[model samples]
Target: MQYPRKSYRIYFILLLIISCTGERSTNSKNNDSAAHNRTRYFYETVKATEDTREKIIYLDSALASIKNSRDTLLPLLLDYKIFYHNSLKEYDTSFFYVDSLISLSGAHRDTANLAKAFYRKARIYNYLGEQEEVFSNSFESRRYYLAAGDSSQAGRRTLEMALAQISGGDYLGSQETATEALSLLEQEKDSVYFSSVHNIIAQVYHERELYNDAVPEYRNALRFAPSLSDSLSILNNLALVYRDNKDFDKAIATWDEILGKADSKTKILRYEDNRAFTRWLKDSTQDVETELLDVLRLRQELDEEIGLQASYSHLLKYYLDKNEALSRKYSEELLKLTRKHKNAGMELTALQNLIPISPLPQTRSYFQRYIHLSDSLQMASINAKNFFAKIRFDEERKQEEIISLEAENRIQDLEAQRMRTRTLIGSLIALLLLLALSFLIYYLRQRFKREKIREVHKTESRISKVIHDELANDIFNVMSSLEAVAPAPVVDQLEKIYLRTRDISRENSDIETGENYITYLKAALTNITPRDSRLIISGETKVNWSRLQEEKKIVIYRVLQELLVNMKKHSGAKLVAVSFAENNKFVEINYSDNGRGLNWKRARKGSGLQNVENRLSSLNGKIEFESREGKGFRVKILIPS
Candidate 1:
């Protein structure tokens, strides 16, 4: 059935994709016998069908259930399709599938499959008699197979290409290709292909009419022949070359060996005919007619068309001078056989035989017929080459278009992925910058707190030095003068004032900013506690006081002291508690008192209490005062230790 051109292309690509993907899946995971049997069913069905259209129909039917499936035998199905089309000489359709194989294999980078595709292309070109294309395509197949490390296939393709070159009369090129094939196969130790390469080289030499040069190659081919059938075939070829070289003795002797080895009647008759013909050529007086005629009759009876042509040519040559009418009769028989087979070479030989024997009136007609047949063959060969070339060119252009579209799609996909990657990178960079900014803010705030606390320490140190060094010294000197000259009440009052000045100096003294700091703080708190009020310190051992900064430690010590002093002087409370605790994130200290509390809103801030608020604020800590007129005066302090 006919279909639109687009439909065929679509179908081809679908098959190509399915086949390659399925082939890979099969290699990796197809172990089920049922799946293999299912594949076998389809593969055998299509392969067994000889008719091209019928095979394609069977292929379509088998593939009907294969829609978008990972069928394990897709490659087999494609192989049979190519096979059936090639058998029918439908090279265009065959080429279509081959190019699809190339595209699919290339898309997946399947080196072996690409070699197979080129091999099929070269074979089709061989059928079209386009030897140039055959050689080129075969070379490509060999190159790919070699790259895939398939030495046997590489050698086989090279030898086949060499044969193509020889057929096109490129003797030197054929010799070189054959030698390359030999090099490839020898390493593999493949006797079958090794012998084939030698045979190809021998043919190349024979085609140049260098019988002496061809002898050794043929011998080499015979030496490497792997099987009995192959050995006989090579022997028969060797004998033919010997006869063509006019070495009739050797040719007859070679045929004797062939006849001895022959197991079938057909083989015996063919060998006997060749031997008799060779002996007749060697000695024209020999009575070889009976044997030659008998071979011809037997071949005809057996309907062996090829053997009949050979027999007729032999008889015609033998009778050409002695019996004109008999020679003419044999030539006519040969011509009929050649015509039946449509073998242009055999027909040309037949026409050449008839030309010399025909009557004068018929001579020109026979010559004209020969010339016409030769020209028709030449024209047909040229036409076939051009036709196949045109198909290849058209297919290649379409292939290029398909490749361009696929490339464009791939570029688009890559661009999209790049865009996504860029976006993700940008997001990561932004998140990093945000984290860095947060860390910078935290560092600056901590630095500011530390500097502020240092300033408070420096101020307190200056005040303590002034009281002890300058003020207390002047008071002591005045008291010493009053003790000697002033009234007793005046001297006594000045002495008390000097003692209070010394007490203020001691209160503002430098703090111990070390491990002994907590001990010093506890002692100061206990020393200041009134006789009536009790001081309680809990959870102090739980705090890792050494981890806190020196300035923060000093501040904590001062604040606690101020609170205890105020409580002793004014609060008149029974109990005071200072608690410390450490958690995963922060160190915490809670100071609370149960004392007679004044109205918190109405209470004025004394210098000492205000000093406590300033100290806590500098360290990023918190404080709360809770008091009542008739209830206990309570102070709650929270310092981030």
Candidate 2:
């Protein structure tokens, strides 16, 4: 779901430096002593104010209060400004505030808040109907979020990106991006976003006429509905799906149920019109004309353009078979409304209806108009898709170019730091080099040992990089292109490949030997284990992990990881168990699986088994394997503590 990082620095040197400036003069300090509290009060008042101008006034005051201070309130105030101006349809002003925040966040090297700046800009562009900017900014926000390890925020950005793609007729990309968002949202259990993602997926399926697939996804959206309005919206979508698939009975039943609970005049009107149209479709003899016309007049009174489009189309369809004059009337009304709304798809539908009923001269004119508009819309749709593809491609290309520039920058920075260190050491050595030769020899020997340890970690990082850059990205590109064209089984298999490649990349990456190491290790093991198999882990808390060398811990992790991979691939295991124990000198792990046993005597050591052996050998560890023809596979590993 995530690409290889743009900031791939292998080393970090932490140095804290404080300026020697004296405390500020009280007279020179800003007027506000409690800047934080005052700014918070201003922000809260803005949130409570419904009037746009009043809200902006409070936001401006808050911004002025923090104008000279780089206090955290600066970005908070700017974000509020952007949100408020955007809602008032003042996009230029919204973008101005967004740019200000982006600059401030960048100056402070705050990637998290920088991501917010871009996300806010994406929202503004989304409202302006600029799909490319929406997708680009949303993706930019996601990159920063992923860099910060905030998957929940990254997922929200991705969901917005998916919505933009779908709006631009990029259905396949939208579906794939939505699914990726779901994966990022897996740990958050955020009902609102969960519902949004599934709703996106359902809409994609509905667009493709995969009604059966869309049905369950809508149900899933309903399961996570966070409010009554959201629930009613999803229920309306579900009924539409049923209606589209021609299961009219189910559609009408769903429509009637939601009609009872529909709280707003708009929703009631829409749902009522939908139910009446669906009933007419179910039984052409049904008399719904009176209800449909009344809804149309009400929609006209309200000037509801969207509702009127549906009403015009339904009335046209009803009169198409019986009343030529009425059909013509409705068709022209639909065409005029669609053109005014600038809805090309509905405009095409209106033209189609008009062409069939109009006189010869009008029919010819209508047909010509339809052809021009249809061809133009089709071309635009196709170009929109490619433009999006170009946007994504350009970003990947830009990232690739940045990789080397960043690497060189890091190298130069490191070299400059080393030069400073060497100069300091040179001065000290000139005075004491010969005086502490014995100590110098011991220090050099320890430095060599530390370098060797670093090499081990560097090697792990290289392997992870190879898997990600060489395998995962390439697989992702292939999946993106093949998603709409490839057979279902092939796509599914490729998806599995992508998942496994990512897992391998993560599994072989650097190990964290901190207190959370055990938690990460346990989660890794759980992830690799087959979902169908029951896994029992014992004595994980009993082991004295602090006693083990960091290198030894890495080896144990890799060895167990290999075993799990081998089990998942080759062992048809129903139940698997791993037990850990450690004493004064050694740690031992026993892994067993209830599956078709391997032949211990003639076990041709596979790559996975060999890798496990090599990792254990590097740590001076020992392993024992036991298996038979019809029994089960078992492995016991021992490493120095």
Candidate 3:
């Protein structure tokens, strides 16, 4: 049995709907599974420790797990890989990961992830000592963080930026950045970041030897420190600042506090070394040499090069008078360590320590080296200060310019708004005026149309009366009078009178429309053409006359009749041509006659031609007349379909 056609269509539609639903369900399940896997891998890697190798293993495994998924999580994983490689100091591998993270995050418009990625890149660059790259990437990260509305992250990055500036010897710039970071973090009330910012500021002042400025900043850092360990670290730095300022009492007290709180042997050794130095400064006769040597041995065992440098410097200072060999050995060791660490400030200090202790020639050589290094360092510091001053000046100028631009823009906006308001008002007024003019024109047009109709009615009535009462009666009377002995001229005159009366009646009658309207129009034209005239008609059959409205056809019929009549009565020539054609929107009619051409100016003043123009105007049509002395007359008419 065959199914009905409607049933077949319904069955086919049901099959398509089920197929589409099944396909969508399968895709949704796949997407969900992929999302779950990505989330699982990300969590697994994030929970891993900071061991670079271990982090790399986890990240590699996670990447393998989601190798086919190109989602937001992919960039996040790549960012973690960059951080791990950077921690391992594998710079080339780290940069590769950085590039990958940037590409993926940028492509996905993951602003938060991109910000974190740039921040990691900045940290790596900082470690590589690429000062420009560090500054640029940090700025980029801060901008992206702000754009992502992660203000807390942006504040933290600002602190990192301050630290970077400090490392680059831009102490003033560092101080400014630290203050900015402080302002941002204060709004957030982030105690940890606040502590960090204060610490950085204090370090900057301390480096500049502004111990008075540094003391308050360190106190602030201590007050805001979030953890015991962080507080201890700040206290240690505070103690060092006191020692540098020669406040031996405060320095010893701070070190005692650090020693009491410090849990590890390394911390105890560090504070001990610092306290020993402060004691030696206070009284050179104190037994600080053994304590310094003990600190040096401990630092060497721990392989802490930085701590060893500090220990060696203190030991050399202590042994300067008592043991020349040990003093020189410690100085050499300090210089070597400072150079290895690329600490120019410490190297300068070490050179100064060595110069006075060496023999005549060696002392002279050391003194010269010291002077050269000092001058270079001084010049660098001066340049850094100048650079920071220029930066501040430019920033201030930019702020002023921005303020000026904002004022100008506000004025422009107001002016534009006023112009818009004026334009709108002008447009409304113009529109109202146009409507009033249109109403007046329409009123006049309707009034004129009514008057024309009334005139046509009156003419029709008068013509009908004349035909019935006067012309018909005269024709009959003449016919009766010459019935038996009628001359040919009298008989012809009577027949002419009858035909003229009939033609007048037809001209004034209502139009025949529809299928037979074209035939009526053709007959009217043929009747008006004189028998002697050579009528050449073209394009008449080509026109779609059936599409034309009845009123339009009547107007065309009247205009053509008027033209033909005028041609026969005034012009004695024979040839007359008429053509009709149509376009998409209009029908065009061309009529010409070889006749005594009209006086162009006088013809425009004639009432009969004006009536023809009025009739065409009522139908929204136009007519053009071409005539010159001794040339054929031509008329072109266009009527909307």
Candidate 4:
């Protein structure tokens, strides 16, 4: 009772002071209410099952909180922005939010926040297809993660970065990333991140054309994802890779295992996917009717109209090669599918396949159809590019607007006092007028200079095209005619002259666009490679040469052409296999011959050998020649992609 009297006296004095000040009741109460609302909203937004749906709700709550109070909850608002951009695949916007959060975090210095920022930046760079930027930011993220001493979390990010590298076609880079991740996750044997490392290694192997090496890694990934439904597709891809490596027995057995586990109630999509592989395995024989019937059965059971058309297209090629009566059956099926899908690309493929097999009278009609479809598809691709460009442009514009607004606010604050002065405004006006006059003069001069440059470029382009087309064509034709004449002293001299002229023509030709490289290579090889037998040019035959750097790609193209020519003249090979592997760091050419093995000593004096050596040397590449006395010849050439 005595202590209560003293405490009561102190409490009365404290309450009197608080009443006199009276500032906290309104502000603190409002803040508490706002915080309560925000907490409720945050929980409600985050409660969704789906990631994208949750992100949408988060964004809505964030926008609402901004309306109520932005200064107190800017950090969460920034997080919301990041989540929104990530969901929408707007990576740059996500990066901006991350950066904002880092700056706002102040003395707290959130390491996890910085890690996330760096990761987001890496992801953005990946989306923009900037390889250097992707690696740089990914490494930066790794550094931050390392500094934070979060090895497991760092390993997961490393795995994701490895996947980015893989998608960018950097197989070696991905392999390194995967190895690093594997080392980090080694202690955690049952960790999901460790499983990802295995999958990434498989992908890297797949990209490097080491399908055999990929099998076990994929199998390991499957083990980790055993009960997870997403693993099914990856298993299918692994099986297909096995099949590609001609391990069909294993592929079939694995697929059978997949089918056995697949119940009717599992999922329709999974069943359909399994059916595609099962059908593919069944058709891996040389029987056209049997394959066609299998394809027809697939069409009956599965709702994959597009896949059925693809099978039919393949069958069309098979029948044309076999001269089978079932050609018309597949062709009719293709026509039906094409009409249903109205997919220009698929329609063009079907028409092209049908063209060779259709009756002679029907050939022209199919050719016309093919041309129309191809043109439409090309136009659609162009439209898509334009659409993407427009979206990118709008994003850039929005970013610019935000930058300008912030700058404007800064400038307004700096000039807040000066803006009231008419004298200061007059002085600024005079300075601006002088600047404008100078800018006008500079602009006129630059415009004139650019116009002059344009004119010169146009003239050069015209002359180049004219010289390339008329003179080169006429000289090449004369050289062809002269080669047909019997070899003599003068004829040999003339042939040397022809070879020199051809070399000059190729060197002087356009390397930048290189649109004619593949076409010219095709023509040159056709003239040189034996036409009397089967030669297969597989693996995305219609590659856009413009995607390559002119000089290097031309070197590869010419090298392949020379290889084919040598094969025709010397190898006596019946089957020629030419493979084009487009990848990051290197584009490889695999040319194999089923002809007699090469004699290195004899080949030393060959002109074709000399030509290949010269071309490969110019491109800073080397040829790996594989041949025994009797088996066959295989030449692998690698160059920077």
CA RMSD of all predictions: 8.0, 38.9, 17.0, 47.6
lDDT of 4 by residue, 1-641 (tens): 01224543453344334324433567776875776577557745665535875666565454444322224454565576676676687665566556655554432466766676777767766666665556656666775687688777678777876776665445676787788887766445536776678888987788677997888888888777746554755676687777677676667676666665654432333444444544454674533356455655666586667667766766665666455567667777788788886655566766776777678878899898778777776665455444433433665687699889999988997787666576688888988998998999877765554455344435545666666676656766775677767567756666666565554444334433255666666555555566675677666364455776555655665577667767766778888888777766667778888888888767857887787886666545778888876788888887765
Q: What's the residue-level lDDT of 165 in candidate 2?
A: 87
TM-score of each: 0.66, 0.58, 0.60, 0.39
Candidate 1 stretches greater than 4 Å from native: 1-61, 65-69, 73-191, 223-226, 319-336, 350-452, 467-505, 514-516, 528-531, 536-549, 562-571, 579-592, 596-641
lDDT per residue as tens, model 3, 1-641: 12225543453344334323423476666875776686666557667665667777777666555523343356667777776676677877777667656655675578987898889888888888866567667767887888888778888888887877787788889899889887666444688889989999999889889999999999999888988888888999999999899899999999987788997877888889989999989999888777888888888889988788889888887888889888888898988899898888888878887887788898898888888888888887677556655555775687789989999999999999999999999999999999999999998986776577556756776787777778777887878788679888878888888878776766666556578877777777777788988777787777787776555676777788788888878888699988999999889999988898989789878877888898888867898989997997988899887
Q: Clashing pairs in model 2?
A: none
lDDT of all predictions, in order shown?
A: 0.79, 0.84, 0.79, 0.65
Q: Model 2 over residues 1-641: C-alpha lDDT tens digits?
A: 12112221110000001111235677535544566678888988998998989999998777655524456677788788888887888787777678777876776789999999999989888887888789989999999999899999999999998999898888988998899999898644666898999999999999999999999999999989889989999999999999999999999999899999988888999999999999999999999999899899999999899999999999999999989899889999999999987888888988998897899999999999999999998888798788778877888888888997898999999999999999989988875877688778877765554456557767877898899989899999999899999999999999999998988788768778878888888887888888998888899898988766676767777788888888888778889999999888779899999988877655545788887887676666799988886699989998877
Enumerate residue pairs that collide in model 4: none
lDDT of 1 by residue, 1-641 (tens): 23226766888767666555544465344454455566567667766766668778777566544543344455456556677788887888777767766776777677887898898889888888777788778877887898899888888888887787666555676688789777777544688788888888888778778999888998999888888778887888889899999999999999998888887778778889999999999999999999999998898889888888889889999998889899999999989888987777778888998888798877898899899999987776565445434544765687799899999999999999999999999998999898899899888888887887777777777898999999999999988877878999998899889877886786777888888978988887887787787889998899888888987887888888888777777778888888888877656777767876666655546777888888888877777777776677655666675
lDDT of 3 at 632: 79
Specify the highest-lDDT model's number. Answer: 2
Predicted structure 3: lDDT = 0.79
- Weakest lDDT window of 10 consecutive positions for candidate 2: 9-18
After superposition, the stretches of candidate 2 with alpha carbons farther than 4 Å from their true spots are 1-51, 65-69, 186-189, 401-641
Candidate 1: residue 65 Cα off by (Å): 4.1
